[model samples]
Target: MTQPVTLSVPCPDRDCALSLARAAVAGRLAACANIYGPVTSVFTWNDAVEEEDEHVLTLKTVAARVDELATLLQTRHPYDVPAITWETCSADDDTLTWLADETR
Candidate 1:
């Protein structure tokens, strides 16, 4: 059985987020994607504390496809160092089946 996973990628703006989501889904690297916008983020970068508004793009995919999806996001993302991370998840059977089918 394939494992379900969720990837969280923070983008500099809404357009960037939407572009990543569209490309991933269109390429079947992800079953689906959700974009949340204008979230305040505070972090340390370049040895300095920074704060900015960003969009959180979440992708639903199988573990097997995560690497490809990450590569795609990295290549297209606007940030010099884009934040990309994933987590394994348990979903209901129907959802899991749908995810697997869509991704494949």
Candidate 2:
């Protein structure tokens, strides 16, 4: 059986978040995408510390889909260098099962 993975991506605006979330789920690039509320982000940009409030999304899917998912995200994302990060999850079996079944 293929192992599942989780992704956490940040979108600066609501429209972008909704668009990416819908596309990811519809295309099966991600099985699930949980859009979060506006959160404060402090990170370095252009060698300067910048602060911006942005929306966050948590996505879950299989490892086989990560490459395609990343491509889809980058193609439609608004930001030139948007955050399209993912991680392999090993939290628990139940959560892993849930992620695997999300597309269904």
Candidate 3:
């Protein structure tokens, strides 16, 4: 059975996050988006681990629309190197059905 995919994007600020989220949902590239700000991230970059404060957005959508989501995210991202990652989910059938319906 096909399931919803979860896409995570790190944003430099709230405005960029909101724009990306709205575009994804309006374009039917994402079934839903959850945006949160003021996240503390500690990760590696340029061969070193670093810490930063950023906004995070998680987009839920069907697997088939992942490429669309990627393109939209990359284009709208504020970061020179945006952190946009996707993972297939194992979620309840009902939830997945709703996502499919709403995205259309």
Candidate 4:
């Protein structure tokens, strides 16, 4: 049984987020991608404090394809060091089935 996962990524803007989302879904690297907009993020970068409004992209896929999805994000993301994170997810059987089929 393949494990489901949710990947979290922050993009500079809506366009970038949408582009990544489209690419992931089009390539079947992810079953779906949810875009959340213009959220304020404050963090430290290069020893400096920075704050920005960014879009968040949430990608859903199975564990087997995570490496490929990550590679896609890493190569296409604009940041010098993009933050890519994911967690294993629990879902009902039907949802899992749909996810697996979409990704496959």
Model 4 per-residue lDDT tens digits across residues 1-104: 86999999999999999999999999999999999988999999989999999999999999999999999999999998889999998988998998899998
Each model's backbone clash number? 0, 0, 0, 0
TM-score computed on alpha carbons, candidate 2:
0.85
Alpha-carbon lDDT of model 2: 0.83
Taken over the whole model, the C-alpha lDDT of each candidate is 0.94, 0.83, 0.87, 0.95
Please list the residue runs of candidate 1 whose C-alpha ends up more than 4 Å from where it truly belongs after superposition: none
Q: Rank the candidates by lDDT, best first.
A: 4, 1, 3, 2
Alpha carbon lDDT of residue 9, candidate 1?
Answer: 90
TM-score of 4: 0.97
Considering lDDT, which of the candidate structures 3 and 4 is the better prediction for this target? 4
Model 1 residue 53 lDDT score: 93
lDDT measured at residue 21 in model 2 versus the true structure, 0 to 100: 91
In candidate 4, position 82 carries an lDDT of 86
- RMSD to true structure for each model, in Å: 0.7, 2.1, 1.7, 0.6
Prediction 3 global C-alpha lDDT: 0.87
Per-residue accuracy of model 1 over 1-104 as CA lDDT, tens digit each: 88999999999899989999999999999999999988999999999999999999999999999999999999998788898999999999999899999998
Give the CA lDDT, 0 to 100, for residue 1 in model 2. 64
Cα lDDT tens digits for candidate 3, 22-55: 9999998888899887899998888999998889
